[model samples]
Target chain A: MRHLVITIGCEYGAKGNAIGRKIAEDLNIKFYNRDLVDEIIEEVGIPKEIMEKVEEGGTIAGKGAEGDVRGSFSKYADLTDRAIHVQKQIIRKLAEKESCVIIGRSADYILKDTKDIDLLRAFIYAPDEVRIHNIMESHNLSEKDAKILLLEKDKRYHKRHLALTGSNRGDRHNRDILMNSSYLGIEGTAEYLEELIRRKFGSEEE
Target chain B: MRHLVITIGCEYGAKGNAIGRKIAEDLNIKFYNRDLVDEIIEEVGIPKEIMEKVEEGGTIAGKGAEGDVRGSFSKYADLTDRAIHVQKQIIRKLAEKESCVIIGRSADYILKDTKDIDLLRAFIYAPDEVRIHNIMESHNLSEKDAKILLLEKDKRYHKRHLALTGSNRGDRHNRDILMNSSYLGIEGTAEYLEELIRRKFGSEEE
Candidate 1:
């Protein structure tokens, strides 16, 4: 089967992963997110804990632990870089092998040159009120705590995007569509994306 | 009283003039077009023959028989430029005194700096098929003749826009809204414009 890559991008609690999963289910395609984490760990030989920390955007040893001059500092840095490199290779490999939906890791920029790839890049966003409510319900946190966590996660994602792509977090211009999830709610948004994908590829499939 | 500049832009046979007249009536404003020729004869002190020669883009005199050498040797070369400049000043003066809708003098760009001006720039367009039908009904022309006339008019308008504004004719990034008059028809488009103007300024007038 030919491959189609769908990238779901958003800040935390904006339902990027959930949307990607729904699209994959509707299309009957494999979806990859944290599942790639294990493949990355095995390939890079990095410790699972370190991989998880980096994946969640925790600072590496030197940056986080103020002046911890350990002898194995270089080793930790190499492992982190290698793990990232392996994850990117796996993503490319999956795209080559079959149709799949990828949630983040800057998939849009990574596969910019590949042909016959229906690269549907979407930005999912919600107003602050709706986002805060979603976070509270999902995490079972107090309003204040949810707000704090949401803000921090947003910042971390923004920083991660900048670090990975050296550009703004969202590709507003390159994206085929920009969705305000508030307009459609979660399930509606997924259905909308499915329709868009079908419109783009339906004729080709026939 | 404030002057409202209404720019009637279209790709020939697009009913720009008709739409402009309707807008003027809806707001009890004076409309300008070929009727401006009579006004210019009175205001600019130019002879009626000279106005006619330049009415539909006559050339200035001495450029060639095809050109008008009087001003720039192109048909309507002398009159079109004079009309634009005179219309600009008249629009400014009229705006100072009362609200009015000035049509098809590139009024949007001309009145860019005027205060208390609610500039409504509109582009009216009809598909070729619709334009041909309208011309056939209004002018008693054959389909082929009407099509030729429409094409020529479109070209003239395009050249006029470039000459006046250094931009393609009816390219409406400058306009607030673009309406397909084919769908709205003449009266409906006018009513819609009236509703829009009322929505924008109704409460302020109150």
Candidate 2:
């Protein structure tokens, strides 16, 4: 009686990607995080440089360097838009076919219109100072550089999300919950969310 | 190793008050909601009509009544401002002495600077339609009236919060989590929150 699907939109150093994967493992569901970028790259033939920029959590606001995308502003925007649409199709199919946890890529917003599937959308964020320290440790960057990187990633995330979904991630109108990763850490958060999701969509006989 | 203190900020009709009280019960901690207002009224000698107005979640932007507090706008504003000061004192005292769950009145922000205690702040909100329907059913009002009431309460909550704390409740830099009550209902939400609170503040040996 459970068709549980969860989408996690997260800040850069919040470790939402790790939390989502842990939840999927605990629930024995399919986990789709980086595999998404791979699928879009394979299916849509998104340029490698563009995908690499995306991996760096950057917006396509600047110039692109080579042959495929032509480096024009409008064309770069167009390619990113096209990639978002393809990502949407891939997300919808995954939700419709099986239970999975999707990390970012606006999957929560993408699957919001469905009624038959049990979907739980959560955004994981920690304090800026905590996230900054995390990025410093993980990326071997200075405090100044980590702060700059965090802002850049956040801006790019919002820009891409707004273009595709007409809203940002924290637009909680359709989202189910928001969690701060600091209090529970990745494992504890996954444990709590797993229980919460089960309670939300579990069989009535319980 | 637990010095438990929780503060709940909520949108109208989200049942955050109920959730807070239930968490207190489950945790066997002190519950502070209306009592905070009553204490402010007693300690500050705040006028009855204004407290009633405050009870209705209305800002002190307008006039007051006769006798104890002059019916002038300035006097009315002065009284409520003084009451908020008393309320802050009461909140700090409670957090210092005992474990408790406080509802609204910006207790979360009031206690944000402390380090001697364990604290978890949560805001509860529901979908507009669900909350509006709840308002209509509970207050016996038309949908239009219910929507108006909801907006008024939210505005006053923010206005009072800003005037007191220089920030609003949904401000997440200091708050811990936000939960939507529609999917879990009050009891279910309370149950999860009880477990979450214990996990957040319990002994390290666990």
Which candidate should be chosen as best, given TM-score against the real structure? 2
lDDT of 2 by residue, A41-94 (tens): 566676666555544333355545433455476677666666656667778877
Write the residue-wise lDDT of candidate 1 on A1-206 in tens digits.
Answer: 56578877765777777888898888888788755636554655766775555554446754735655565666666776776676667667767777788777767666656776666676666667778888999999999999999988877777666655666665443344445565456776787677666655663541
Chain A TM-score for candidate 2 is 0.80
Q: Which stretches of candidate 2 lie over 4 Å from their true place?
A: A48-81, A203-206, B34-42, B48-83, B203-206
Off by over 4 Å in 1: A35-44, A53-73, A203-206, B1-206
Candidates' lDDT values, in order? Answer: 0.65, 0.78
TM-scores across all candidates?
A: 0.47, 0.82
- After the best TM-score superposition of candidate 2, give how far the Cα of residue A80 lies from its true spot, in angstroms: 5.7
lDDT of 2 at B106: 80
Per-prediction DockQ: 0.03, 0.59
